[model samples]
Target: MDELVVRTEVYADPETVYEFLLDFRGYAHYSEYLREVRTVSGDGGPGTRYALTFAWWKLTYTAHSEVTGVEPPERIDWEITKDIDAGGCWRVTPSEEADGDADDGSRCEVSLEVEFDPGSASPDALDLPRLVSFDWVLKKAIPLIRGEAERVVERAVRDLEESTRDVDLEVYVDSDRI
Candidate 1:
């Protein structure tokens, strides 16, 4: 399995960031390929199911997922149920400045972490268009998927900062491979 982690520090508190991350629907706007995130069942909490549609060029796939875990004001976890074997988590925590003191809830670090094995999922179940093989699509998409993870977090940070305050905030994206 390959893991990707994207992080950024926000001028908002942990609760604020947590609430923003809790709403999975907003994620569709963060990535260009992500067309929609529709709720299938339950609320935003654990047990909620979602259909996340991603489209690029002539390819479109709707991946099913379920909210597997949630910790208020801190974290949310989900597992993909169809077309792929993947899981991800959103983490929000108070940021500690250089002086080793927490920012008194004024600033926090927000992170999105995902784990997936490109080869683990079977292509037989995929609904591919005529003359388009799943292997061909995977070869072309694997690289884009990695970059998409980074792009999503970068956009999410910018949107969150813009929504929190009127003034523009500096955006810094820290990406890690694990």
Candidate 2:
């Protein structure tokens, strides 16, 4: 089993960040490698299932996943059910300095653990010899995951900003009409 942990500060509120993380279908809008996402069962609540595909190394791998835990505006955890044995979590913590007096920002952390069976497929499946010789794959994968998480955080912030802007414009228009 290989584990990767990434932590970063996002310039968005905790609630907003948490909500974005739980929006499984929106992952492709943020994750650079995720090519597609679809809800398979349930309603994105705990135990909801989803299918995700990632485009990397000129190959697309699909994984079935289920939400393992969810706590609004705080934490969410998920486990992969097919293709690979993996799990991940997203955590949001309030950032006093970035938020100023409004509590508008948070520090986000994402962690992932994945284990692949080198013997499951052909000898060339994962280039096992290369992995043993140079540790190339895991090294590359960790940084990729970190960058993806960062991008997701940025996307969440942008989404929140756009939503707020839209709401403010609506309020202004309504006030003028009244």
Candidate 3:
């Protein structure tokens, strides 16, 4: 399994950040490779399913995921239900700077963690050209997938910070293979 941990401090209340993450439909806007996100079932809560379409180079694939857990103003968890074996969680917590004062739109720490195994992912969902082989595409794409999570999180943090407030933000990323 490969894991990615991205942490950032945003100038927004915990609930606001949590609500942003809960809205999965907006996720496609954070990454260029992510073409679209369509709700497949349920509401924007636990048990909600989403189909995320990703396009890169000459390949396009749609992955399905389901919301597994939701804790208001604190956490949201989800798991990939099709194509790939993966799960992730978004955590929002009040920052030390916003402990007691500045209740209205205070600062919060946001973290996203994802664990995925490319070897466990099926290539059947990949839309490939007629002559291309799955093995060749997978060999090339797996390496890119390792770094994709980091890129997405980096963009998410920057965009979230910009959208919420005009503040300079720093994103910390840690990746490991388990």
Candidate 4:
């Protein structure tokens, strides 16, 4: 088993970042490797499950995931249960500026650990000897995953900002009643 960790900081509030990450359906908009995503069971909170289909080596494979932990506007973790070898977490918190202002923006980090089985009875075959010789598979996949995660976060932040730009907050104020 091989493990890799990748982290990135996104410019957004914890709540906005957390909400975007929780919505698996939004992955297709940002994740370069993910071709399609479908929710198989439950909503996006803890215990939610989804089927993620991605292209690997010009072929597509589906994986099942269940949310293991969920703390609103803070952190979320998920476990891969079928057709894949990975678990991941998304963490969000205020920046260290001491202002406690999410509107000023914050940061978020995402990490994943994956293990590939060389002896599994699966369609994809692992070249054990080559892996031992050069460790190419691990080396290649980690960077790819890291890049995809970064792209996803970047697109989500941009989308969030654009969606909120046209809202008018003054409409909520009732001057006559006051």
Q: Model 1 reaches what TM-score against the true structure?
A: 0.87
lDDT of candidate 3 over 70-151, digit per residue (tens): 9998999999998778998998988763365645557787877878877787767776799998888777766675456556
Report the candidate with higher TM-score, 2 versus 3: 3
For model 4 the local lDDT of residue 101 reads 50
lDDT of 3 at 89: 94
lDDT of each: 0.79, 0.60, 0.77, 0.60
Span of ten consecutive residues with least summed lDDT in model 2: 168-177
Q: How displaced is residue 51 in candidate 2, in Å?
A: 0.3
Candidate 3: give its CA RMSD in angstroms. Answer: 3.5
TM values, all candidates? 0.87, 0.63, 0.81, 0.65
**Pairs of colliding residues, candidate 1:** none
Estimate the TM-score for candidate 4.
0.65
Candidate 4 regions off by >4 Å?
Answer: 1-5, 98-143, 163-178
Model 3 lDDT at residue 1: 72
Off by over 4 Å in 1: 163-178
Q: Give the per-residue lDDT digits (tens) of candidate 2, residues 32-99.
A: 89999989998878989988987776445676889988887778889877645567676667766544
Worst 10 residues of 4 by lDDT: 169-178
